[model samples]
Target: MTERISDFAAIAGRYALRQPLRIELEETGMNNTTRMIYAGEERYVLRVYDNHRDREIAGTEHAILSELQRADLSFRVPAPVSNRDGATITEAPDGKLAAVFGYIAGQRPSPESGAHVEGLGRAAGELTLALAALNPDARLAPAYKPYYDFENTHAAMNEASVKTLCESSPKLAEQAAKAASLLETRRRLTALTERFKELPQQWIHGDIVFANALADGDAIAGLLDFEFCAVDARAMEPAVVLAEFPGEDDALAMNRMRRFCRGYGSKAGLGADEIRLLPDLMQLRLMDVWLHFAGRLAEGLDPERVWLRETERVSFACGWIDRHRRQLDVLFAAMAERQAAI
Candidate 1:
């Protein structure tokens, strides 16, 4: 990592940018190495893709942003800066794909701030609406595995390899047990998957956690990171957002969830059926997270301690969602009714 930062001079020239006075590593996000580049009086974000194959994902992201730039949305998004050859991505000496983007100015929201939570909800809603306007294209199709798919969850839960991986941690073991019991019920899972298949499909920002949102005071100034962008179920977008937003308590979390749904309702109204299916979709999102970590553990990439923390968090969230399922149904129903009236 030290060597990569020191070699920024050669890399920066590829994008027609001057040598950086300083290159500070932005040590956030698990997937990529990002750096803040200071070149003379200008600033930009330099992202080094984790794998060479990520170039396709980068190309798709660039296209999505290009389309979004035309929309009159409220929040700003990262715009890809092209190299001298008009290519958005360039290869480094190590065969990794990298790109520079026009810097988006703002900071991530404070975890304890209710106003920031609401702003994030509204920003996600606005982005969803804007993305809806841009017609779906083949480039937006997911290049990686579909983590949110129920069939994927079903397979992962049943795998002996995954079971062996879970045995290493008590939390994962318990989650595995719970998954088995839930699958035994079977009817709900089957119905939920069927309903999910019926929901509208479109290109969505696959990851919309707080870290990807930039806030200025109480408002969302920009939405960053579109590398996970893909064509998927529309409900999955709000489901992911609601799962990620921070809330101090169940009451606060419920309120935040309602606000998010309302914000999304304002632009693209949820169907009554879609409203009814939101809880299941939310549960599915949590399960998706669980499976992702389990996969990481199985691959020997995640530490048992870290995997335990993630598994426990997902397990607790699933239970909480189950307890408040009825309340969420009522809130989403009201939102759908209001949208119908509008």
Candidate 2:
């Protein structure tokens, strides 16, 4: 292996120039392991990518970071550490790619922080707007990629190879089959894609959940994680945010939706069709999660894991499907009506 935690000390010892005072690992991130090394009064964030991530992806992330830094947006992005040759990337002992960022002093926000939510929305909106402004014709290396057509709900569920992975486990067998069925239901809603005719395409932060953002009270302190960044429908960005937020009522959700839309519209306006499709996009988000849960269950993940580790998860997903089924129909009808109106 090229990048293991044990070698981190030696790597830092070579780079810090000055003696490091303390180094500690942060455990929150799932895809990459992060460590904070304090060299005297200054702090730096060391990020180690997973083995599955290739060098090209690392270079792509560097390009995205460089773009965001130059965009001069109203948020913090981790700065890459330049080597003795002023290169941003350095290979670790475990054969993994490593980069460093100046640590932003802030804490990850909780679901309850309204100010944080607003700030996050604003930051994301700004980033989306900036990315949208960039010409699609810009020259990029082979590693730089735009996010596109990643809505894998149907394909993942229907894959025969994926099914085979679950067949040995009875619990997963049922869940995988259910997941495939749900995906079919979602497939029936393909007409919604036409709504995107009026919706603009832009670069989007694919994962805008709370965990990936940092806040100081209601202010967005930093936006992190560009691994899933890609080009996609502009509305898809807000849809992703709304999908992750926790709210029990339509009123609260609508409020959040309005905040997000208003922020984005203040810059780039949304068409009537795009507005109508927002609710359906939110539902699509929910369906995505359920299908993912089913896929996990099929993959022999604990029948009951975390909050969803129970037989009831299946029933809950089904209940959500039944309740939202009519809403989806209405939403699709609204989309058609908007198309007619436009």
Candidate 3:
């Protein structure tokens, strides 16, 4: 890590900083190489693009954050700290695109913390409301491709990938078969694409998993990591957050989802069509995860031994979601109604 830190000395030099800059590697997401930098009394985050694809998206995220800062959002979001040359993104000696941001202080929430869950939901709602005011075309520097796009979903579920995924594990194979059947019987693929097209599109923080959110007691102190941000169907913002709610228990998970939807609806109220499509959107989210993990297993990339556990989680969640579809629809509908009345 120290060796990698040294490579960014030139990039760090571009920033107007106090003497004796200290760099420490941050162990977080798999996508980016993040470092915490201390320059005298001030702290900041330096992120180096790990993949080529992310390099293209960096400018859009910086622009989006800049816009969010101007909005005076209630929660803390990363503010781009431009270098001495006034460039938010600087090319490193190694050719990786790097950017600096003012550090936000908070801890990642524990799965068992109820306050954290509610706080996350509230923060998500507030963030969505704030983002809704921004026009995607005005803020995004380079166009972004959404990970949750129905076209991507179709490609992931194509026959070849499905076969490979099913062949990787017997347990997953059964689940894959079920998922494929559900896709057809539910008319999920066509319905989602059509509905998504009809719904309003907006710039969204596409990845709002727990790791990406920071909490202070019962409040969300910071919303971190906007690498997956994009302009997409508005419902996807809340759907992604709800899908990633931390828990292994089905009842608890459903309760958490209900709380999240309620929180979101309170601020950025869902439309009648969006409310009706909520259940399917969530199912799409789960199916997306299912395909992602299954693809990883098929590719034999379980270096961390997390794929099996993730696969099990996705499989069970999909089945559970299918069984309780009617209940989820009712819950979301009620939330929308309450919001409308308010």
Candidate 4:
């Protein structure tokens, strides 16, 4: 892997270039390249956008973070660092959008701790309330589409596309055939399209999985990676989070989900309608992953291991969610009752 440090040299020049600069590349984040920069006593993260490579989108995220930094939240949100020019955004040598954020103090959370899972849910709830309070430009929302548009957003992810992918290699055929599950998810979400509009809409941190939620002790302290933030169904916030905890099977994850919903409800209450749609919204989140991974595999950007895991994830989670619909409704209703909003 090319360090590409030299490519970022121009952008890095904007910040205080302390002697013997040290930049370490991170191993995570599929859509963006991240580097940790140590400048004297201060540590910061430099992210180069690979998903859209659009400066406006980066600006939108920075704007959102700026507003969130001032919001009435208990935890921390990443604040973009301004350069010498009093600007948060700068372009790298490759013309990709890049920005530096003061490194938040925390570690990746583990699912073993029920408090941690619950804390992440609480963080999700807090963030949901914060995003709902923001009144940014209406244009900032349209660029980032909701997860419900899984099919159109990824035009080539249809059944025929996956069939072509399956025929491409004998080894991929079995795993690749699972794309049908995504098609099914889209169908379900499609049937509820009108109802979704009737519920509510707001700016949301569309991706709130463990990788993006940082933990200080047993509770989530900071939220990272707003690159996927967008306007979507209000419930998409928690659904995005719940979709990530489908451990081994559904049993372990449901226990965690219970605690999560409790913690979340304590901060922000869910409406009766949102509660009813939680299962489908969670399934929507899964198919969104499916579409993303399938899009990557089709483009030759990733191997089958990448897409197969997502396909298998969708299959397991959606199946389990379908089997436990009544249980989900009950759990969400309990969550709404526990909310501080009520």
Candidate 5:
């Protein structure tokens, strides 16, 4: 087993003049391994990316944070700490990619808390509004698309890796086909990007799962992790918010969904069409999740640590499709309402 903290400290010591007095790893995030490092009076976050690609990804994250901060957005993001050479990237003892962030203090809201639900919604809404305020023409690399890419998701599931899952479990195949068909319609609609009225697109945090957020009381204390940030549809953020919740019942999931939309509307303001597209977008997001984990498994990566309840993920996906089928119709209805309202 890899000792995460000691690994982090060893990485930190190489970059900073003083080694951390203590390094505590936060184990909740799905992708990156995070550690809270206490060095002198300041607290910093040490993160190791799951993929060891080039340092350009890190640079993109750094740029996104700077832009968000510069734009004076409504939340907190990691601010990279510069070393003596005024550079954020530092070679660790283990020679893996590493960077540190200023730590902001806050607690994640319990899943059962109504306040937590509202906070999650509001934070997402505010982020969407803030992001929309930026220049849509802003340039960003394409690596950020996989998480929110509706088209790529359609391709992934029908492709070889995930198709094997469908073949292994006939029920899974049936459920996947139904889900994929709905997503296909959404994909076709989204492709006419020029035809649909374009909302202002700017830098968006590609991944906003539960762990990326922090809350104190009913308000978001901080919004951390921008490693997957890129320029994309304004709709992607709220779509992700809907995808994160794994409630046992559609009622509870809808409750959370409603709260999230209301909160986002508080800041960003959602139209009827946006609300309608959300359900399709939500399904699109789930398809992405399936492909994401499937891609990992196909690549021979162990998913024991990735899914919170590993064995149940497939069942949950199937259940979600079954329960939300009615809601899918509702989404289309909402879209029509949006067109009329507009």
Candidate 6:
């Protein structure tokens, strides 16, 4: 607690906020320490990253936000604030890097709302185009491996490690066994890899679940968190978002996904190949999540249930997609046709 208090004091000094500013921890994100800061009439967010320690990566995140602010899209995104030295990333006393973003006052949109889901899609589509334009920067750096780079990405997550971690509990073991079976065949599918090779590559936010976006009524107030920004297949952008659509069965899931795609297609183009590969790409996204959480649990950073929840979600999503492959094809084809018509 003393260390935390000292860090807050240093942050206030460096940011030139009023002395002894009121800072309270925000109990939301899983990977980072987020704090809401109150300075007289102003408010801001202090994000202390837990996933990566590289300042260059953080700088690239800020640069992306800086460029996005210039893009002037229809909605808002987190804006990085510069400290007294005009540096967006502040080195904390304990060596972790931190940055403050202007606070956005809005709530996370409901996934159940068609308008909210559609709006999220439009924002993603707009960002896809904008980020594509903003890429190949000399300062651009990777925050996390792209989802499709399964080998280099999941190499550390070996079966032995996963098995040992699973032994800790029967519930987790079942989730692990389910994940292992589901991922084995899908990850080895040559067509998934080969098809996406022809698609365009560009910078994407890489993580865009609904929690990352703040909504004002039915509209997107701002997009938050770019910690996973990476240069990847352009189509991978929407697939990541689509994987976040939740439902008990294929119809309900597809409804939300189709709405998101309609909104996205209306704003951006999805080629025939891109459209066809979306289902496979979305499965890959789920795979990444399960593997990511598994790795986190193995390293003792996360508990069993945290990983279990995501594994179950991934398990259900993968099966849901497979059972409805024909619908998946029709859905994306429709999305492509709609985009072309527009």
Q: Which structure among the candidates has the greatest lDDT?
A: 6
Best first by lDDT, ranked: 6, 4, 1, 3, 5, 2
Ten-residue region with minimum lDDT total, candidate 2: 141-150
Per-residue CA lDDT of model 5 for 1-342, tens digit only, reads 365556776677756545436777565366666777777787788877767646777776776666667655556767888865677876664667778888877887655777777677677766766666555333335445533454554454444544465455544455565444534544554564443235435667766766777777666778887777767666767777666665677677666665655565555655555555555455555656655665565465744344223324534654575578677456434434543454
lDDT of 6 by residue, 56-132 (tens): 88988899998888986988888999999999999888888899988988999888899999999999999988997
Point out the higher-scoring one by lDDT: 2 or 5.
5
Model 3 per-residue lDDT tens digits across residues 145-233:
55446446456556566656656666656566565664463355455576677877777787787888888877778999887677777
Q: Candidate 6 — which pairs collide?
A: none
Number of clashes recorded per candidate? 0, 14, 0, 0, 2, 0
Please report, in order, the local distance difference test score of every candidate based on alpha carbons.
Answer: 0.73, 0.61, 0.73, 0.80, 0.62, 0.82
lDDT per residue for candidate 2 within 45-109, as digits (tens), equals: 88778634576667666777777788867778777777665767777776777777778878887
lDDT of 4 by residue, 179-201 (tens): 56656667778788777777688
The worst-scoring run of ten residues by lDDT in candidate 1 lies at 179-188
| Better-scoring candidate (TM-score), 2 or 4 | 4
Give the range where candidate 3 is weakest over 10 consecutive residues by summed lDDT. Answer: 182-191
Tens digits of per-residue lDDT, candidate 1, 50-129, equal 74457677888888898888888888998888999999888876778888888888888864677777677677777888
- Candidate 1 or 5, higher TM-score? 1
Candidate 6 Cα errors over 4 Å, as ranges: 18-20, 163-169, 189-191
TM-score for each predicted model, relative to the true structure: 0.90, 0.76, 0.88, 0.93, 0.77, 0.93
Give candidate 3 regions above 4 Å deviation.
53-56, 138-142, 153-157, 168-187, 245-248, 294-306
